[model samples]
Target: MEQLMEYLLHYVWQHRLYGLAPLATTDGQAVDVIDPGVHNLVNSGPDFFNAKVKINGMLWAGNVEVHERSSDWFRHHHDTDAAYNNVVLHIVSAADAEVRTADGKQLPQMVLSVPDYLQHNYQALIDEETYPPCYRIIPHVPPLTVHNWLSRLTVERLESKTDRVQQYLHRTGGDWERAFFITLARNFGFGTNAQAFEQWALTIDPQQIGKHRDDVFQVEAFFMGQAGLLDDTLVKAERRDSYYMRLKSEYAFLQHKFGLTPISHAQWRFGRLRPQNFPHVRLSQLARLYSERRADFSLLTETSSLDALRALFRIGVTNYWRTHYAFGEESRESDKTLQTSSLNLLLINTVSPLLFACGRQRMDEDLAERAFALLEQLPAERNYITRCWERAGIKAAHAADSQALIQLRQHYCDGKDCLRCQFGALYLKQGRS
Candidate 1:
């Protein structure tokens, strides 16, 4: 019973469902409910009522208590405050009292409940583990509504990403190109090495880094060294021949010349990961990309298609990286090339979103649309978050659903802001209205 009540409260609160219409008065009076505002006593207390509420053809006002039950109002003490005087309805789940407003007026209300099937369905979803029960069972759901919702949710998701991007942009002093490079490096670092990549960017000045454009290998070496991938303690070979050694020496030269700070010796985690995903290789790829496209984000801004994004992100490693994962590996490197899907993930998750955000800031809808299309073309990402939504009877046919699923997981489920969700109250009411 407690769990059910808690769920109901969460559902209502998350969805802002409290004070909704069809409220029942304490005396079981049947009336049409009107604009149910949040009940706050401070402002309304000075008057004859603690709150002002209305019912069908009646403008009710008084200090009366509302609750899941009439007994709870007394339990909570509405009689103490004149602020509750305007409560025209003694709304409750079960009515059993002769409650009155401070103005000495009796309030009317209505008992509201929803269908049983919807309730059971909602409960099953809230408690299930399966993904896409509706998609798997019901031949189809309405695509038009789903599509529209997806589009709306996807843009909302982008706005959130843009918010973070804007913060980074401000930190970078609105240098979109430098900001983008740092973003790309962070994304390339994947989940584990993001800190190291960011740290690497901080040590190297973006303007000076552009000078080594002719030799992509030297550029990659500098980035790799700055990522702490060229530590002499970790490498087995001497500093002149091995990849790590070469990078270390080059980095030392650059640091001396430009007075650049050394990247911290912090581990850019590679454990439990495929060698291809090692921070060294990622940094190399990033440096190669920057070296090849000195114009950086300006070039990316001009790009409009998935093909162009793929081309931009596909910058290959130098010959040395083609045969090595780390500095000492001489054996045939199996994971020599970056996967196209991985590139798409970086572009969609990192580049495209930032581009869209910048586009919106510049009032360039066309650029934003191009970024949107790139994201849409990619296959939806499957994760625990999406699985939960699917279990909840929500189906995704595209990236919009994926975006909503992420937001749902981040801001709603994980944050426990169920009452703040659009589907929460209705979903709860459907179960036990």
Candidate 2:
């Protein structure tokens, strides 16, 4: 029950979801919450920062700490930490014990009662079997409200992706080109092999590959060999894949020359994947792009049109991959390349985020605007999530809307964290009028 209280208290306090009545601290001093303060997601000092409140007709500005019970303050040892010294108000569902600062000054404590409507409405939303908890209210929500909320969710989703790119830049020691490659590689693997591709990218040095960029075969040898695809154990053992042996031999020489070690073969997942999505095909296409200077970040940012970006990522695998999905196994000869849908996905997931991250780091507003334009230019993704939202009366008009829906499904819906979601807030406010 305490855990449940802790979960709901934070959002309730932030949203001011309490009865409209005069309030006072446990010691009978008047208190009025002005701003509940910013919810601290990343830091350790306080649950909220820079809160505003009026205590006994005096305006007090400080941080706020909240919990299921007031005794949790000492249980968490905030009283001994100097960081808690600035916390002017301790809000809890129950004032179980007196809290103090490191200097032993008793802190003002306020008990916030849970509104019965919120608890009942939240429970109903959770109990509902619909894809979106607030689907019933969705149709009633003003179109403008839906539009504004989706716009915010879209930017939030993009910003989250941007944070990932920034971390890559940090890990790559501020090398934008290397960071872009890793980001593209992960997206190239798209569904199943994304993690394996990222691990594979981290092992290979981008600068070392640049030296042999003139030769596509050398690049293939480096990429395939480093991915552990050339290993004898992974190939279908019945047929001796000569092309595999050839690349293995070449990679042997290159591996010796560059002092490189391949990632373990066990890392790659193959079951249930299509022929085109196999590591060999995708990695070969990547090798082609890298060797041909097509995947260069500087050139990509200079591209201005959606068609131009499509052409940039529309790379085909080398001749060997064109004939086979795996080493040693030959299939019908066909032109194997990124299809239109695949190209769109690459643009939506990889290209836009890269542009946004580059724009922010370089302080170029054009680049940031380009990121938004790219999403706006693309069609909505045809997936279960979009279909689900469409069933809920919220069809995605573009990639931005689809991405926002996906974000909502993943972050808010999956966690049942409706208290922090706007849609949930509206559903809870029903019948209050």
Candidate 3:
């Protein structure tokens, strides 16, 4: 078993899972646990602190130390460290050795007794091969319990994303617009090219792009060139394409003027991607957005309704892209517009998180709540993880539910952090009862 099983011991102790039987110390002295004490400590001294217990009809209050085996107390060399001097109880899964303090005084030890079925159930979860170790038991949990957990997990996901936005804001010297642009650019990748897009965004100054936003062609040239899509060699080889030639020439002038370096096109991926999701198409759509709404980009955080937010992203690529997914390539005529699914992704991953971060930095609760409200109005995402939850009989009702499930799967279930998960904890508790 992994060392994480030690947390299960902590859970058993915290919830007093020793059953209705009388408790006692290792030396056969009757014992009673009055208060499990505070488990939250910033700097660790012991596993638990300020515990109050009655031993042999005498009350004793001190710290409680836990381990898988009593010998770990000495194995960890707690005898030499003054930190373990005030330990009133040494709770372990097995008491294989006598524990003594630094002053050579015998400390009370107890072997924590847990129900056999609980341990068996936890071990079964650990050995389970499913993505969520407790998938089989998820439906057994009360709906209210699952809803409460999902709500908390969704906020946790939002807070984590908001933290990233805050880091970017700090890196950009508190420039909210630039941070938003970088985040939006990354999201445009839609998971396939997010990293390359982020690197490309970092290379071009948003102010430089904003300077030429009045001309959609100039914005397109700058964005495409910075993304390394308008390389001189590639453009020269496709000289027969007038639109490619124009962008190449404009990018050359802009590159020299701004002394801007472009990210390598080798970083972009094209395999297994839909034609509409090609990097060239995504960049064009992003270029159109900035070209039309450079000055009002920050106003997106204040958008209250889902329709208003959706309206802001209702933009299509320039006419040049209507017949092409990339330079020097001709396909059937089609309007390269941001689809509803793509728009929903942007609102969930980029817009809402940015809004939440902005609200937190400004201490505006209304804006933060508005950001969460927008998530409620959006539809649930359809992806492999959501489908896994669906197969397990957990259907996500909205974006918040789906987002929370994504978080739960990635952070808790995948890592086998059952002790920290509500579902896992409930499963263990139910098995014990």
lDDT of 3 by residue, 73-170 (tens): 88889987799898899988888999898978799998886678778877878889986778888888899998999999999999999888887788
Candidate ranking under TM-score, highest first, comes to 2, 3, 1
Angstrom error at residue 354, model 1: 1.7
TM-score top scorer: 2
Which 10-residue span in candidate 1 carries the lowest summed lDDT? 131-140
The C-alpha stretches of model 2 lying farther than 4 A from their native spots are none
All models: lDDT?
A: 0.63, 0.88, 0.84
* RMSD for each of the candidates: 6.7, 1.6, 3.3
The sequence of per-residue lDDT tens digits that candidate 2 reaches over residues 303-351 is 8898888988888889987788887778998769899999998888888
Query: Which residue pairs clash within candidate 2?
Result: 241-328
Model 1 stretches with alpha carbons more than 4 Å out: 1-33, 37-52, 55-125, 131-140, 237-242, 333-335, 382-401, 409-433
Error of 3 at 22 (Å): 4.2
- List, residue by residue over 1-433, the lDDT tens digit for candidate 1: 4335434533332233555555444454445433344543246332123344455456654433335555555665665556666555554455666665556655464343424554465565556444332334223435565566567768878888888678778888887876777777777777787777776775667767778877887787677666666666666555335555667788888768777765766656767988888776677677677777733778788776777678777765677777877665664754355688787778767777877988899999888987788777877777787776666566565565687778766766554444444454333344344
Which of the two, 1 or 3, has more lDDT? 3
**Residue 91 in candidate 1, Cα distance off native in Å:** 8.6
Q: Of the candidates shown, which would achieve the greatest lDDT relative to the real structure?
A: 2
On the 0 to 100 scale, the lDDT of residue 199 in model 2 is 93
